[model samples]
Target chain A: MKILEDEKIVGLFFERNEKALRETEASCGALLRKTAKAILESDSDVEECLNDTLLSLWQNIPPAVPKSLRAYACKVIRNLAFKRLEYGLALKRSINSELPLDELEAVLFDLKTENEFSDVEFTLTLDSFLGSLSAESRAVFLKRYFFCDTVPQIAQDLCISESKVNSLLYRARKKLRSVYEKGAEL
Target chain B: MKKYRLSKALGEIDEVYIEEVLKYTEDAAAGKRRGIFGRKRIVTLALAAVFIAAGTTVTFAAACGGLQSISEHFTAYRTDIKGVGDTSSLPVIENAWSIGKTMDGEQDALAGSIKVTSAVCDRYSLYATIEFNAEGIDIPENIPDEELTFDIINAKSGIEGACRPVFVSREGDIFTYIIHFSESSSINGDEIFIEAHNFGRSCTVEIENIGRRLVFNSVEYCRIKFSIPVSDLLILDSVQSLNSEKIDGIIDMDAELSPFGFVVRYDESQVPAWEEAHSELLKQYGWEWFKYSTGTVYSLLSFKMKDGSTLENVHNLIATAESGSDPNSGKDTIHFSFIVPVDISQIESVTYLGAEFRFDAEAYD
Candidate 1:
C-alpha cells in the first residue's frame, strides 16, 4: 500500500479528518508496535498503548505541529509503553536478564539524589554525546535504549552477531556513563 | 537520575537521531541491507556451502573441504562469523555456483606457503578462503584472538580494497582464514592481488612453553601475497525502459543479476523535475532534508517472482549518485542490490518506480 506522506497525514490531523488516524497508523503502526512490544509484554497492553498513541497524535497535532510525524508518533508510543510498564498496567514479560531499563542504571548511578540538571539539559548532553559516536554505534545505541530492541533482534537486523551487539551496547553504555558523570559534576 | 527519566530524555534528543534510528529499523524490518559494505557473514558462509555442494573441487590441502573442515578447529575471533558450523543446513544457500580456482601465494618467512583455496564472487564483492601454513616453525600453543588484516589490490589498476577476515581457524601448524573483499565501487578485474599483512603485529602467537609472545616485528615476517583470477564469476544483465506517473521522469534501468544479489542501475537524470524538487528540499532543510523526503527512489524498485511472491525491501547495497559538469543536469546513477540472492529465472517481472517490466524466461537460460 502506498502510504500517505507525513505532511499530508499531519494536515489531515489538523483538519480534524478521521482518515488522519488511519493514515498515521498505516505509515507508523508497525514501528510503533515494534517499539511498544519491546517494552510492554502483553499483547492486549500493546494494543491499548498503540490506541493511546494514535489518540495522542490526534489530540496533539493541531496545536503542536511536529517536525516529523513518524518521530512524534514513535515518541508518544514509547512514552505510553514505558508508562504502562511503570504503572503496573501490564505484566512485564522477561526480555532477557538485562532489561534495557536496568542497563541504564550504571550510566546514571553517579547522579543519585543530588543531581539537579533539568531533563532538557541532560537531553542536550546526550545529544552531544550521541554526536560524538560513530554512525553505526549511534544507531545501535538508539535502537537498544530508545526502541528497546532485543540483542538478537538487533543482531539479525544489522547482520551481525549477538556478541557484537552486546559489545557495542557495552561500549556505548560505558561512554554514556562517563558523559553522565561529567554532567553530574557540573 | 532515573532510568525512565533517561529514556524520556533520549526520546527528546534531536529528531535527526531518532529519524536515523527509525530509518535503520525500517530498512531492517523490510530486510534491507544494513551496512555500507553489506557483507553478511552468514551470506558468505552460505556461499561457501553452495560452492562446495556444487562439486567445485578446490585443490587446497587445508580448506578443500570448505566450511565444514574449518569449523572443526574454528576459534571465535573479535568478529565472529555467525553459523559457521551449520552453513550447509541453511535454506538460503541455494542457486549459487562454485569457483574452485587455486592460486599460488608468494612464499614468506613467516610460513611455508599461502594459497587461495575456495573462492566466490558477486559483481560487488569477493569471498575467498586462504590457508596459511606455518610448517617447521617453533609455534606457540596459544594464539591471540586478534584478526589478520589484508587488502585486495587490483592487479591492473593497483587500486586497493580493504579485506575483512570473516572466520579464522587453526589446525596444528596451519591457519585457515575466510575473508571478504568488498568495495564501494564494483570489484571488477580479471585478476587481483591479495596482500595479507599484520600477521605478527596484529596477531601475536604466545609461546606458552617459553612463557613469551613471538611477535614478528619485521614486515616480511607478516606479509604474504596471492594472485587469483576472477573472470569466471557470472553476472547477468538486462535493460528495460520504464515510465511511471509516480516519478517525474522515464527510467532506463539496467539490472545485473550476480550470484550474491541483484544490482538495479538507473539514471535519475531523466527525471529533471524530481531532481529539482530534491534540490529545493535540500536547500530548504539542509542536512535535515532526508527526513522530509517522502520516499527513496530505490523503494520503488522490487521484484515479482515466478513463485507468486513479490520480493519487497530489495536492500540497496550501495547508492552512489554521480553528477555531470552541470550539477542541475541531474545526471545520476543509482545501484540497488537485493539483500538475498534470487534465482534469475524466478524473477518474472521487475517493478521499477510505478512501471512494470516483464522478463522472458529464456533470457536467463
Candidate 2:
C-alpha cells in the first residue's frame, strides 16, 4: 500500500474522509503504538487508548490543524495512554507502579515554591537557557524530560555511552537550575 | 506544582517547536540528521520544550484507614421516583457494606452551609448527596454543567486523585455528586479522603435584600475536605459464569455478572478457523443497536432482573488483544465490560437485538 504524505493525509481529513484515519494509522501507527506501549502495561488498554486517540483526533481535527501530524498524534496518544495508566493504577492493576516522570522532580521548580514563580515567566527563562545550549545538548535534555525517555534509552538511541548520557543530563539539569535560580532571584 | 500542573504547562508549548523536536527525534532514530532544524526553529523548539516534566502526583485529601460502623438506614436503592422516574427501575446504589453515613460539613467562604446527606460507593464510583443552604443567596441547583472540581484519594493505595463525576444532578435544595474512579480503585477499602471545590456564581441568585435583583459579584467558591468510611464493596468474584454457545466456530461468548456490573468477552481466535467470520460480523454489524470500529464492536447488553427491573449496560472499559501472523491479518479479541446497578444472580436471560443468550443453570456448576 502506498502511504500518503502528511499533507495529503491532512487534506483527506479536511475533506472529512474516514480514510483519513486509516491513512494516519498507516503512517503514524508505529510511532503512536510505541509511545503508548512505553507507558501503559496492558495490551488491551494500549489498543483501546490508541483507538480512542484516533477517534478523538477525528472528532477534533475540524477545529485543530497541526503542521506535524506525527507529533500531534504522539502527544494525543501519550496523554490517552497516561490516563489509561492512571486508571489502571487507581484500580491497583498496573504492572509497573513507577511512572516514567519520577526523575523530573529533581529538575522541576520545587512544588513548595512553585507558586512563587510564574509559569509564563519561568517558561520564557527556561527557553532562553535552552536556546543557549548546543543542538546535541538540547536534544538530550528534551529526550529525557519532554519525551520521558530513560537515560539508558537515550544513550542507546543517541549511540553514546550511558555515562555520556548521564553527564549530558547532569549538565542540563545544572544549567536549568541555575537559570531558574537567577529567574527566581529576579 | 502537581504533575497535572506540569502537563498543563507543557501543553502551552508552541506547536511548531513540538513538531520540530518530534521530527528531530525521528531523524536521529533513523540515523538521518543531515538537515538539522535551523537556528530560528531551534530557538522556538527550546522555548516550547522548557516546561518541566513531572510525573502526575495523585493527591488525596483523606488521611488513613479506620473502619467505623455505619448505623444509618438509608435505602441503598434510589427512591425519588419523581427525579429519576423515567427509568424502568429504581437505580440500585451499589455501595456494598455501606453504613449509609450521612456526612455534614460547612465552609465559611461558600457563604452557606453544606451537608452531605447521603454517601455511597461501589468498586467503580462514589455517590454523594449534598445540600447547600445560603442565608440571603438564592443558589441555583446544578449551576456548573461539566463537574465540580474535586479529588477523592484512597490513602491505602497510591492511585492519583479522582476524575470528574459520571453523573451530577440538582433538584430543589439538594445537589448530587456521583464521582467515578477506576474499578481498580481502593474505594472498596475502609477509608477514603475527599477534597472538593465548589465553583459557581450567584448570577441566578436573587438578592432577597436587594428586592429580587441579580447579584453580579456573587461568585461562590468553597474548598471542602471530608472522608467516608465504606464497609464492603462488590467485586467480581464468585460470579455465576454461563456457558455461551460458540458462534461460527470462530467467535465465543463468555458472560458473567454480579451486583455491580457485567462482563462480556467475544474471542475470535480461540478456535482459529479465522476466515474473517468474526471480523465480518464486527464490520457488517454496521450502526444497528451495536457500533463497530475495525476490530471491536460496541453494543448495549440488556437483561431483565428477577425483580422485573431492567439493567442496561453502560460501557466503562474495553480490553482488546490482537493476534495474527501478519500485521494486517490479525483478529482482535475483545472484552467489553458494562457497569450496571443490578444483581447478577437475579438475571434470567441476556437479550441483545431480539436474540436471547439463556443461562444454563446446570452448566454453571
The sequence of per-residue lDDT tens digits that candidate 2 reaches over residues B1-365 is: 55544433443455455566666566455432332211111111122123112221111111001011111111322332222322335333243322233455535444555554444333333444444444444545555632332222222221124543332444444444444333321233344555555544324455556667644332355565555554312132324355564544445555444344443444332422333445565346432111332122334345655666654542221221211111011222222322333434456666543334655322111
TM-score of 2: 0.37
Q: What's the residue-level lDDT of B122 in candidate 2?
A: 32
Please write out the lDDT profile of model 1 over residues A38-119, one tens digit for every residue.
Answer: 8877788889999999999888988998888888888889888877777763455444344587776656765663257777
Candidate 1 residue pairs in backbone clash: none
Leading candidate by lDDT: 1
TM-score of every candidate? 0.41, 0.37
The CAPRI category of model 1 is incorrect
Output per-candidate TM-scores for chain A, rounded to 2 decimals.
Answer: 0.88, 0.83
* Candidate 1 Cα misplacement greater than 4 A, ranges: A89-98, A111-114, B1-3, B28-365
Candidate 2 local Cα displacement, residue B163, angstroms: 54
lDDT of 2 at B365: 12
